[model samples]
Target: MTESDLIAALEDAGVHVVFLPYPKPGSYWHAHQLIVIDARLSSRWQRCTLAHEAVHAWYGHEGPCAPETEAWVDERAAGLLVTEQAYARAEWLHGPDVHAIADELDVTPWVIEAFQRTLRRVA
Candidate 1:
């Protein structure tokens, strides 16, 4: 989905999105019903961040970061941005290249790496 679509979906679910010049790419402040995404990130990166934060919100994830929580969020974020079908298509067209898959999907290479891992877990 496009950024606008994602924003609309979040708003529809009663979550608020805020763009700010934060040091991190994005954060989910569950207490305030707010999502803060860094304004300086590229559009694709912003989408990925949004997806990650959205997962946190959806799962009602809170408290200090833990290994399992971080891993779960990362996996969900990658799946959201790069679905199984999309990943397969990208791989077929890009020949197993992370950068190329990311380019095709409009997400960062880091996201693509996570996506690759997600694909592996499901295979």
Candidate 2:
């Protein structure tokens, strides 16, 4: 979903979302019961960040403190914003370039890179 659609979904789910001048794209501020997204980030990055934080919200908190948790969450977030099947289609159309794939997917290169890593592992 797009950034606005994700925000609306989060709100409808009783999750508070706020955009402010933060350095990072997103953070799940459990103490405040809200998700904070960087207002300065591009819409695509914002959407990806929301997707990431939304997973945390879905689980009611961050996962257990383990090194793999973040990586797992990253993969899930990327897949959430751009489904694996959609990424495959975009990859076919865009070739095997991370920047190009990210551009096509409307996400940051970092997320694309993470998704690519997952693809490599699965292949």
Candidate 3:
């Protein structure tokens, strides 16, 4: 979906989103909320990152300066975008490789796998 569409989705879910300039430091900020994004990232990365971070807020995730936890956070965020249903449909409907599904969804292949894991976790 386009950035506007993504923003609209967040709004529907009752989250506020703002685009801001990236910090002087390097690296694209995926999202944070209000400060949801550092804003340096291109629009493409912006939407993907936004979806995940917004999910964090929704999930009320708490913590800081933890590597192992960051991986878990990444899964949760990715799960929000690459939802289980979407992943399954993409996998079954496409009837081919995972990369094709990722390409179709405009998300990373890891996202698709994470979505599957999320489904498994919830199920």
Considering TM-score, which of the candidate structures 1 and 3 is the better prediction for this target?
1
* TM-scores of the candidates in the order shown: 0.89, 0.83, 0.57
Best-performing candidate as measured by TM-score: 1
| TM-score of model number 3 | 0.57
Error of 1 at 67 (Å): 2.5
Superior by TM-score: candidate 1 or candidate 2: 1
Tell me how far candidate 3 lies from the true structure as C-alpha RMSD in angstroms.
Answer: 4.9
lDDT of 1 at 49: 88
lDDT of 1 by residue, 9-94 (tens): 78987889999899998998878878999999988889988988888888877755798788778888887777778888989999
Which whole-number lDDT from 0 to 100 does residue 30 have in model 2? 62
Off by more than 4 A, model 1: none
| lDDT (10s digit) by residue, model 3, range 1-123 | 556766787677666777777562112223433425667876546766776665556555553426655567567767556655667678787875877897777776666666666667878
